[model samples]
Target: MTTTPRRYHITTFGCQMNKADSERMAGILDNMGLISSDDPNEANIILYNTCTIRDNAEQKVYSYLGRQAKRKHQQPDLTLIVAGCVAQQEGEALLRRVPELDLVMGPQHANRLQDLLEQVFNGNQVVATEPIHIVEDITKPRRDSKVTAWVNIIYGCNEHCTYCVVPGVRGREQSRYPEAIRAEMEELGRQSYPEITLLGQNIDAYGRDLPGVTAEGRNKHTFTDLLYYVHDVPGVERIRFATSH
Candidate 1:
């Protein structure tokens, strides 16, 4: 008998940032030699890289998680992961709501999927919501498009908007080092990626949390500096970004 190359299906909801996170996570899985799947029920691994920007979006994740939870009960080998904001906000409580889930990790944990899944394979369910120092970008994501890509220049948020819970859930901002970002851009160029949209909950706030040099010998860092650093990377045709107030 032959086994499959562990298939994964990701159901994403919410905003452009979530969509981009899904792609990057997908890219990470593909590099781990997993194949993509369209049906969550058929996949050995089902990842719901969800969002909780609205009440409906959060409730919907539970409903959808319900169906998969049932499937996992019937298919003991099935691996189910709940990722992104909902996982961040609810944390381990998500497991109480759906005890069948094998992993619950937040959005900031996207790049660490492989290690977390390994823990799951060892018969330990995992929840990685506690704040962590952002790792260097090394994993090659199985990018979704040749025409466009989402490059996260920063991880997490610090805004602490009164109406939002992101800063608490995502933790403090940790910008990717300038050299590593350039290296990734260069790799994307080699892969023929034509465009890259710089992603962040606050794109305009990219480097505010990091140390930097200034024209007047003052401590200064801005998203614009990061932009100019990557602006001329080869083979990239276009660049766009967003900032949420």
Candidate 2:
């Protein structure tokens, strides 16, 4: 008897960070023996790792969700999930908007996909954007073929830039313990990831909110401090970071 690999289609929208998240998730799915489908209608599982960075991205995700929601009515077995910023920012409000969605999870919860899906197949819909300590990036990411990779030095953003919903949605700046960040970088080095981009909402303001942090050389113990902290992670050739406010 031959069984086809369970197929999944992931529709990604938003920035490099979200794209990175989706790739990591796709890696997780690959570990589970699921193949990705280019066609949305043909996949047994439909996962939308949504983005809410702009109004257009949010609306687009909703429109796609609507179509999938309607499809779920006809194909009762079609598993539906909405992940990333919108799922976190909106939470159960998403269920109010589209009750047909099987799961709603946020960026911080990205590493928990397999466990959440396990709960979904168990017949319970889930929303898991609650703030928690991002455990560790133990799952192998199905990275894009570029020699560059994004390594999140911190989880969540404390800077509640008024126009931004990151703090409310993704939670506060939880910098990975400097030690852990170095370890992750060391591993990436072993994998030959040549260029690494440290992720954050505001890199200039890293450890201001966290305790046990102080100045690093001429600067405060902010993202820059951490940069010096993990700069020597073995095998890493280069490093960079991004944030406007």
Query: Which lDDT values do the candidates have, in the order given?
Result: 0.82, 0.82
- Candidate 1's residue-wise lDDT over 1-245, tens digit each? 98768999999878777887788788888888898998777799988887777889888888988888787788889998999888999999988989999999988788798899999999998999988887875676666677888778876677787898878766787877777778888888888988888877766667777776688975476777778889999999888876545
* lDDT per residue as tens, model 2, 5-69: 88899999887778778888998899889998899999989989877878898899989988988
lDDT of 2 at 137: 77
TM-score of each: 0.92, 0.88
Residue pairs clashing, model 1: 27-141, 27-142
Error of 1 at 86 (Å): 0.5
